[model samples]
Target: MIAAKFQTFLILLTVLAGTALVARRFNIAPAILLMLSGVGLAFVPGMPPVELPPELVLLMVLPPLIYSASVAMSWREFRNNLRPIVLLAVGAVIFTAAMVAAATHYLIGLPLTVGFLLGAIVAPPDVVAPLAIARRLNLPRRLVVILEGEGLANDATALILYRFALAAIMVGHFSLPLAAGEFALIVAGEIAFGIGVGWLSLRFRKWSRDPQVELTLSLITPYVSYWLPEHVGGSGVIATVACGLYVSWNGPLLISSATRLQGIFFWDLIIYLIEGLLFLLTGFQMRALYEKSKTFPLDDILFATAVVLTIIVIARFAWLYPATYLPRILSKSLRERDPSPPWQWPFVLAFTGVRGAVSLAAALALPFTLPGGEAFPYRDLILFVAFGVIFVTLIGVGLTLPPVVRWLGVAEAGRTEHVAEHEAEIAARRQALDAALKSLDALTAEKEISDEVMRLLRARHEIRVNQLPDSLDPAHHDVSAAGTALTRSLIDAERKFIHDLLRDGQITDETRRRIERDLDLEEASLANREYREGPL
Candidate 1:
């Protein structure tokens, strides 16, 4: 069984990689493409059925994905947009779920608990699809930040609500006050436990002083964050997000530069693989749903899917506009701080609530049997609808989002901010050059470095300093850009020489690798001076 599982996993990985490449080449959303590929593969002859067990997704997939996203989010921006983030993450989730439940109960004729269960499954927008596409688009930074913050935190609310609704179904009773208290306690415990775990992990990594060891610890930290709170009957999603935020904020002070770089690349690759697999698994779900959904009339299933998906989409708009404009209307200070964006921005945000891996995982996690030994209510129907909603939102809305942005003329509101940020980066580079020069002077004064070494170091810094623009003047900008290009070309020439030497067997493989690592780091430093791509 183990070997067979491994083989199947390898096959899926290959398929994911292939689909991702194709999607990228065509500039299409890879999640949708990969999912389509999975669905097609499912129907192939003699292929083993693919199943993504909920426990596996919640345990293995959710933690690192959540942690990486939370860490990558700009804490400053998240704080700045706290009002919207909170409204969307907490308020929007509740509102959407409630509306979905009501619609499902009345329009689709499902029981209230089952409707709530489906609501909870579909409530949280999956960050993966929107974020991946948004990064490529020239979205307003504030919009991106709010979306990311909501994505990072919203899962916790939806998952907690799902648990409560499921429990209510199984036990045949629930108390509002009790549920409220439990919710508060779970959130509190998750926050406290996550912070405690993150602090300890950070300290341990600092003490070890080994980049590889620290990287390994970073990999496991999210899992530990998740498991600890879960073991104590708290929300693991909240625990992981809190832990990620704390560690990322403190990491610059505690972690070495080498470890930070390595961690970034490692987490990027990990997320890419996991995210691809998730979409693939989502597609695989269609097969199982196809077989089971036949128990219900096909037209009824279609009706439920359309009604549920429509409700989910409309519910977002219902919550977003009030959530967005109300605060600015009510608070004079807020109005000044965040001038209300045009109505189109909120509409775009509402449209961007694309659901993905999380919803599918939650749906799949439904219990097969209740404690009373009765088959779980609407299990097949729920799965079908969940898959249907994911497809509609992830593919349909995702495809339309870019064109809609163009149509609304809201595509490039961040242009001025982007320019200002670039100016800041150049200024920082100049300061960095000055700092390097001062450090060389100090070393020379202490006789710790020879005059020749100091001069060489000073010269390099001078060259880099000369290449940076002192003003935002267009002519100066052109010169600075040209100089940067020249610098990169010189670096490329050095790399080519090294490659030639290695091809001619002049250096050992290990030596070549060491040299390549240095060159890569240098290139990364140069690229970051222009623009930093943060964590995954």
Candidate 2:
């Protein structure tokens, strides 16, 4: 069993790498391309079928992905858009689930409880696919924040709803008042647990100055957050997200630069691998789901798929438009404080409702048989319908977003945000340099360091300061042009000298690599500090 599992994992990794290469080469979204690849593989003769265990996906795959996203999110932006986020995350999900459940139950003659179960399965959009595309497309900051915030929290809402509905279906009973009380308790427990875990993790990181140890803790944190709340009958997804947000807000003070840089590389690589594997697995499951549902007529399945997908798409738009505009229309204070967003913004948000692996996990998690041993009602049909929603929305909305964004003229908003970021960078760099200067003075007064070392350090930081643009105006690009040019020339000179030494056999290949890494880090630091692009 262990060997078989290991072999499957190896195959997954190979497929992930191949899909990533193809996606990059063809300029396609990796998540979409990976799903397509998986579908192709599913049909291949002699290919080993890979099943995604619902438990493995939920417990192992989900927490890290959610945590990575939450930590990277700007808490400030998330808080700023709290009203709209709550509307979409909580209200829109419940609304979409109700619409889907009603349509399925009435139109298809399924049980209402079963309909709601499926509704809960596909309600929340996947964080990985949309955010992946958004990052590459350089989406407007506000839109990105809203999407991220929605992704992080909506899953919790959907999962809780799914639990309630599934319980009703299985046990033949449910109480709204009881469910509401449980919901409140779960939420409170998750928040308190997340905060407690985050505080302990922060203290541990501060105590252990080892970067390697810190990275390990960082990797374990999400699982801890997920496990603690989940063990106590709370929402693990909410716990992980809350922990990520708390840790992210306090990270600068808790971690050192070495830890930060190393951890970024580790998390980025792991996230890429997990996302690729998850999407590839999604495609592979398509054939299995189809085969399992073949007992039902194909025409009936198609009709159900059409109904569910259409309802899901329309429900989002129905909820989002009014939700976006209604507060401004109703409240003068809200209107003055937060003016109405452009129509295009809300339209784009409404349309980008792509579902992902989480939905698949939920559907696959559905019980195979009820408590009395009868077959779970419409299990195959539910899986097929869930898959339909994922495929249609992911492919449909993913493809349409770029053109719609261009038409809406939101790229300028992104550019404006970039300029503001640059200004903030400049202020941060100024303070950093000031701190260095103060430290140098203190060191000299105490004779803790030599004058030669202080002089060299000061010169390096001064050059970095000079490399920063003097103002936020794009037209002022020339302000740091001279300093950046000189810096680039110096980096190039170092690189050339290093290579020459390697060619002349004065430095071993290992030595060359060591030197090259340092040079690359230096160039990266310089590029980040500079306003405009520079030669490496």
lDDT of 2 by residue, 1-536 (tens): 77977887888788889888988898778888888888988888877778889987889999999899989987788899888888999899999899889999899998889988988998898877887777666667888899999999999999999999999989999999999999988988897888778888888998999999999898899999997777766669988988888888988898988899898889999998888888889999988986787788888889998998889889999999999889889999999999998888888788789999999999999999999999999998888888888888888877877788788887668866776776686788789888988987887888878778988988988876765667755355554566557877998999999999999999999999999889889877766656233211
Q: Each model's C-alpha lDDT?
A: 0.85, 0.85
Model 1: lowest-lDDT 10 consecutive positions:
527-536
Q: Which lDDT tens digits does candidate 1 get at residues 345-432?
A: 8998898988877888888888999998999998988888888889888888668888888888766676656667777877777788
| Model 1: pairs clashing at backbone N, Cα or C within 3 Å | none
Model 1 error, position 438 (Å)? 4.1
Judge candidate 1 at residue 425 and give its lDDT.
79
Give the CA lDDT, 0 to 100, for residue 396 in model 2. 82
Which ten contiguous residues of candidate 2 have the minimum total lDDT?
A: 527-536
